[model samples]
Target: MSASNRPAGSGRLLTGVAWATLLLGLWLWGRGITDGSGASSAPTTGDIAAVGRPHGVLLPAAHAPIKGTAPERIEIPSIGVRAPVVARGLDKAGGIDPPPFAKSQTVGWYGSGTRPGAAGAALLVGHVDTETKPAVFYGLSAARPGAKVRVVRTDGSVAEFTIDDVQVFTRKRFDARKAYGPRKDGRAELRLITCGGTFDRASHEYNANVVVSAYLTGEKPSAGKSA
Candidate 1:
């Protein structure tokens, strides 16, 4: 969806805003989410109805999407998060795969979507906790506005994004369309996701998710690209 043309309930999960055209459809295909929650029931008829009427917007031409090098690492200093970024693809169920439990400190980039320095919203997902302890994004829900998220890419450049907002969405109200959609049109953006809130022992899942929204403010020089 266009950044300027967000559907109704725009700030929410479902114009499911700016991640990219294919994001809402493919990214949410969860492979048990890969940790243990298993597949989710399909959205209701209302949801199916709302998806058909998406919105759009136009922006100044300067913020065109730039193709970026594949990312290698991600760093969030305030939360003491620094980890390797592995390119993850869709699992059979269709959700973007997350970092495996064994590698608690790692983060996973949705390789099929926008690249770090690219024009559209790039997605990065990680675990909030594992069976025994907190995971790499454990403090994700605590992030406040203006926090910096740095992505080091293969071209030796660093994509720096500033956190615009950090929100927690409950499983019951999880709107995959809104959560994965873009907020601003024509600007490079990022969405960092992880589980949050209380863990539901009955379902073996986190009751909520922490979604941090950021935009490309600048970049570190590399591969002939100037700062």
Candidate 2:
């Protein structure tokens, strides 16, 4: 989702580093990030227009209750971030839903895709700014290519990903197909998202959205044995 599509709120927006850590932490908290269920009451004309477009396969239909557990800790040596995380789902309105962050608490997952290590683009989105204050993901614009991101899952598994690129696009120009399209090799990926660009008081949202693309390197085995 684009920044303009996000819900209005306020606070210090989290930087890219913080957002990554927050997602990892949410995984540790037992909040399943891949539980994609609950269909909207009715599809709008716009939704109908999007049908048959190659934006990627729709997630499965199954909404499991969120367990109130913190995600495992995450450490990104490249960005110098090590913190806890949480998970959350999108609100009734369609947007890049975010979780609450305070007292060292990170936001939760958007819960709209397969698990992080699954064979698809596991989406994790957060807020960039609210009405009164900057929200988490404010610093998302600072990320650069070749950066490293590390996530620890609740199953005592560690996944490492490398930042391939960062792109910023206007709300109108945003392409879900290219942004969330299926990978050629059928590998797992991470798409970290947040709002960006000039904030509009009238709209109470940023003009653009910042997206960071990362490809999974490999998973660490539970046992000492290397995979």
Estimate the TM-score of every prediction.
Answer: 0.70, 0.60
lDDT over C-alpha atoms for residue 195 of model 1: 58
lDDT of 1 by residue, 1-227 (tens): 32245333222111112122123334443211312232223222111111111134221222344568898999999888898999999767455655655676788888988898787778888766555566787777666566788899898888888777666555555666555656777788888876554544454444455667777877777868765
Q: Per-residue CA lDDT of candidate 2, range 46-136, in tens? A: 1111111124433222212221122365455654456555665644533334655342224345565545666666666655555455444
Q: Residue 46 error for model 2, in Å?
A: 30
**Per-prediction backbone clash count:** 18, 27
Say which candidate scores most in TM-score.
1
What's the CA error at residue 182 for candidate 1, in Å?
A: 1.2
- Which ten contiguous residues of candidate 2 have the minimum total lDDT? 43-52
